[model samples]
Target: MGGRHVLRARRLMEGALDGPDGLDEEELVRAARAVVAELGSPGRLSALVAELAAGVGDPSGCARLSYRHVLGFDKLLLVSVGTRHMLRAHVWHPGSHRAGREDIHNHRSALASFVVRGTLGMELYETAGDGPLAAARYRESLSAEVSDWLLEPAGRARLRLTQTAEYTAGSGYALPSYALHRAWCASPGAAVTLFLETGAGRRRYTDVFTGDGRDGRAQAYAKEPLEVAEYLAELRALAELIGGSEELARS
Candidate 1:
């Protein structure tokens, strides 16, 4: 069942990419939501992820899928690179322990996210300025770029509440490029999400910021893309930890 869901997602993404011109944010969101609805919950999605990872095996293998951990959660890259779009599975643990209640940030490319498991509370914000959200930027030795932001003591940048939503298993939402918002997991539980990014790019970059200058938290952070082999290992480890092996075989 779980493997079927992964296949279903792959088919949906392929179809969208193969469409006459291409899928926009709305179309992509609808497609991803369909997959989430089919998978039913985050646990189901995790099983599929584990199954895929276990199949990939070690570094000498030839699995095209890759992975990375960003902002705390383990993310599995579902498709190959140089494609028109990208699909990622975000696996979050008990709390926002890696980055507590994330500071305000936004993406350059449009994305549609589905909550496969647990719950996530999203807070959307808006500012008077027409530029992107406030953030610090840095370059990494691995040739990847990183960005960070503070949320407390908002300082001169006043953020206006624009929208708020809580997404549980089977629920999904879409965000346009430059949409300013942050998310936190509901207490006492883990969360899993699937994100479909259209027109993705490394050069596009991200920004993070805090509310005021008094907050001592570091405003800069590093980010690097995960290699395919390492990503497979992470998935296999997660599969073992989550007891998805039995289901993975059947998948």
Candidate 2:
């Protein structure tokens, strides 16, 4: 028998993907928002963490997939149902030491995120006619063998900022796979968000835009997975943080 948390996560994903013909963009967004709301709740989140920390589920596999993303955040895979759906926790650190301005990029699959703590700021963009904000564009794909990120120069493009928004705890948002956007922690302290990616037919590549002009060479970033111990420690810390936050809210 599976752990309660694992079973609960599977049920949530099943409900989200229950549409007869699968989920459209709007439906996917709605499902993602609803699912995250439940998963990110303090009680449920704490229970999930506790269960995983106790090795009651597939924590080892989840740990192997967890890593610190190049975009300056700790990405912990909570549950993965093949390529159809995935649930993750993103912990974003504050301050300049974290990383420089993030590159504007899109994902291979439609995604949604719910802020569990602190705030998240996001900006949406679109390609524009030739202007001052010209940026170097790259087509990012994963290497077949190691899953390393391979960024190949794809020429220059100008982008126009379409929208800017901030989401605080208890709020969430979703976007299609092709949406061009960037996000960062907007609070004074570390921020945590529960993220969900849905859709089996993922795109092979994603677009990444960087401001600095480079030598037009393909760049590769290796993905380092976490060990079981580190994963458990992180989950413990996450549980404590959520418990503390809940107490504060109640008080």
Candidate 3:
């Protein structure tokens, strides 16, 4: 992937964010998917991923992130963080295990994920019964505070599991800001997922929930900041991991 392909990918990303405002949540997702689909196409997917991997060669352009809120990841790599969007890749190394199921949470921005390696178990949930009370369990925070994600005790509201599926290499998924979802990897090997978050349509705050959607308990987690040098090393490792995947086979 050269600079030309990288420029093309950036254009697609910007197109996803340049849509009209005031559209509904589903419409937002659709708009994002329509643009993201072009980047994921068989003709250009490899170049896009290669360009993202090549980006790591520039020490000034990459960062390593310790997820303060999301856990159970051996590594999380930040490819880029822009004003209206961000790109990240999550890697779960072999033998890593999460203590418990991940929280079912909603994002403030729309998201699209591409499975670069291994498999991911994805589940989406819809709020049933009292939507307002259900949405109140979350607190708003603009800073880096993991404690802010604690679920407040709101009365019980039903959470209907809407969709459950496994996305493997070459597969992608789009999610609206209003969709509540969680993910896990059942395989014994490593799993890698790349995400593109379009922040243009984001809200000020998003909601969070425990596994059962009723538990209000949450423990604050720590964050580790990574320097650009260390992030470059990690990016090199990730690029190799991705290059080895069958998903990178050219059409």
Which candidate leads in TM-score? 2
Question: Predicted candidate 3: what Cα RMSD to the true structure?
Answer: 5.1
User: Model 3, stretches more than 4 Å misplaced?
Assistant: 1-5, 20-24, 34-61, 64-69, 74-81, 97-100, 130-136, 144-156, 211-219, 244-251
Global fold similarity of model 2 (TM-score): 0.92
lDDT for model 1, please.
Answer: 0.58
Report the C-alpha displacement of residue 69, candidate 1, in angstroms: 4.3
> What are the TM-scores, per candidate, against the unseen true structure?
0.68, 0.92, 0.72
Name the regions of candidate 1 deviating beyond 4 angstroms.
Answer: 1-8, 24-29, 35-47, 57-70, 95-97, 129-156, 200-203, 212-220, 224-230, 237-243, 249-251
Ranking by lDDT: 2, 3, 1
The whole-model lDDT of each prediction reads 0.58, 0.83, 0.60
Span of 10 residues, lowest total lDDT, candidate 2: 242-251
Model 3, 1-251: lDDT tens per residue? 22565566666666666665555667667766665556545445545555544552343444544242344664443433356666566776656455234567778888888777788888888888844324335543344544333334544455778789998877778897878887877556677776777766678666665534444543343455556556545555665666633333431
Candidate 1 RMSD to the correct structure:
5.9
Q: Which stretches of candidate 2 lie over 4 Å from their true place?
A: 130-132, 244-251
Model 2's lDDT to the true fold?
0.83
lDDT by residue for model 2 (1-251), tens: 45877788878788776577887776787788788888888778877767766676777889988998888888898887775888999988776465434789999877889999999999999998854578999999998889998999999899999899999999988888899999999888888999998864589999999986777999999999999899978877776666644422332
Is 2 or 3 the stronger prediction by lDDT? 2
